[model samples]
Target: MTRQALVPTTHERGITTLTLDSPANRNALSVSLVEELGRALERYGKDPSVRAVVLTHTGNTFCAGADLKAPAGPYAFVALLRQIAELPKPVLGRVDGHARAGGLGLLGVCDMAFATLSSDFAFSEVRIGVAPALISLPLLPRLDPRAASRYFLTGEVFAGTRAQEIGLLTEAAPDVDVALAPVLEALRRASPQGLAEAKRLLTAGMRDAFDRDAEDLVQRSAALFASAEAREGVTAHLERRDPAWLQ
Candidate 1:
């Protein structure tokens, strides 16, 4: 299927690129976009010619999280994120700009991820009175629990260096293309079977971690979603103002 939300290009060397095309809203994660992304990823995963996948976004921002105006329900967003995480191929996130909330969740799910030196990341959900339910599952394993709690709770933006230091990003390069080149080259050099095996093994190793706390996380998220504070927070953000909770 021809993708409406993104452009998928495959190279002879077996690396597939999925470029986020919805630049108008800073490539916000609309339901359509997430569906398109999931479909494209599923296609690439089934194609033997595709050895690895690279995810990038257009315009100035990598992703600004979910579009407030879009009608993407919470379950849809969470399902799409889970699909990305469960893809068998080695997925690489090439971030050139800002990635926040759900956007940060995308970066966290990738098998390997890199960002531009100028790229910024934040788990700004708490400020909106929502829990980083899906994001925290993948992120907490890669980051220090204390540090993750601090940032997720405070909703503060951090630079790429800090992101790398905290284990959210693997490397910070001068630019997205530069950061991606090495990963692509490495993928090309590695055995596809080996790569897939390693990915499966690592994911299996992390299953216990996820299972242990997934229930509590889901409950926390559900409670946050039902709270008056969350409604007020999302409303205030859509109105481009401070939330009542902040006051």
Candidate 2:
């Protein structure tokens, strides 16, 4: 609980890898971790020599979503996701394990995501009586509408291959680095100005749109999480039982 939440490593190849390091909580997006991640990315944004960012995790879970016990507002997280999406350089998500809820939103913001074939994902907010409102900013843009609707409502787990099928990941390979290497190399080959401009072309105005809508979405998330039903759902989940509505 009192250690570094994110670890940054730079390689000679102009890649900076940010590992979600709080494995004790399965890399939950606590306030401190989220803040640290934002800071790292912001620093990377200012470096012209950094060609790409690799977002990976250190444990069996890529990310288990937000730490429910961490009493913080969604504003920071909303801003963090926006920052990643708008970073001039490409961000590659390398998922070797499971990710849930807010974690899957991170994948949605990636320029490309490479995942191990066995990884799993879910938009699990609805199950906890909260809407995936803030996550929807990035997620809705990339996800197949039908798939998003089904998974968002049902909170069912899906395989990495299925995630790729629905556009959450660019590739689902048996080996994570193997699939990611060529992509990184390709990014490396591109001129920094070219990558930044091309990224602008690919994502023009999306950041502005997120900025415009984020406050309302965060408010919705906060209201739902603070609701009576959400309290019941959280209790039932922790107790390993169905909520009263389900029973």
Candidate 3:
């Protein structure tokens, strides 16, 4: 069997769209997927013709978090997130599906995110006996504190409207494309230098958060993933049963 590219790139009118194409596992961040995405971003970041990049996905789920079967190293994942956050050009998000755990990290760091009203989101790490530590690098700075606390602790699912209200989405509408059109048009019109400088100004706080807490959070995340509780939770999830903690 031939393997398909995990992150596929398409260029249109100065905009580059990078699709997360591994639907079989709900586009989980596997080692290969992260590497491919990181490399693609690097290439696009240096391409003068590419004005901006759109991070999107294919499948009912945009991303279902990490691929436990072949998860990327925490440091590698953190580096990928940093790459996206610090990309000189604007990175937009277009989502029409569910995003959970680390998936929301992708959305959080995007300069702008647009999703269909039907799209859902969750901070599911707690239910899996882990924490949303690494993802907080981008998310904590952007998310509403009260909402973050509620969703992070409860692992509750929220729809796009609520996601927007909580500062996790730039806009959520009946049609994601409709919401994204104007933003895309603006990007297409702006000079690359203007876009890059504007993004730098906007993302300064997020970058600071990354520099300040990334290592400590990465260590915490690695420890949690290695713990017996996380093993039980992951095992129970794969087995389609409740973890011992739930019982």
Which one is best on lDDT?
A: 3
Question: How far does residue 198 in candidate 2 sit from its true spot (Å)?
Answer: 0.9
Question: Model 2, poorest ten-residue lDDT window?
Answer: 3-12
TM-score for all models, in order of appearance: 0.90, 0.95, 0.98
Residue 180's C-alpha lDDT in candidate 2?
Answer: 86
RMSD of 3: 0.9
Instruction: Sort all candidates by lDDT, best to worst.
Output: 3, 2, 1
Best by TM-score: 3
- Among residues 3 or more apart in sequence or in different chains, the pairs in candidate 1 whose N, CA or C atoms overlap within 3 Å are none
lDDT of 3 by residue, 1-247 (tens): 9778999999999999999999999999999999999999999999989889999999898889999899999999999999998999999988998999999999998888889999999999999899999998899888999999999999999999999999999999999988888888888899989888998999899888888899999999999999999999999888999999885
Candidates ranked by TM-score: 3, 2, 1
Tens-place lDDT digits, model 2, residues 57-105: 8889988888877734699888888898889999888899999998988
* Model 2 alpha-carbon drift over 4 Å, by segment: none
In the range 1-247, model 1's lDDT, one tens digit per residue, is 9545355455658898889888888888887788788888889988877789888888888888877678456666666666666677888888888888888888887888898888898888887888788677777778877778789888888998888888888898787677678778888888778888888887774555456765666667768867898889889988999887665
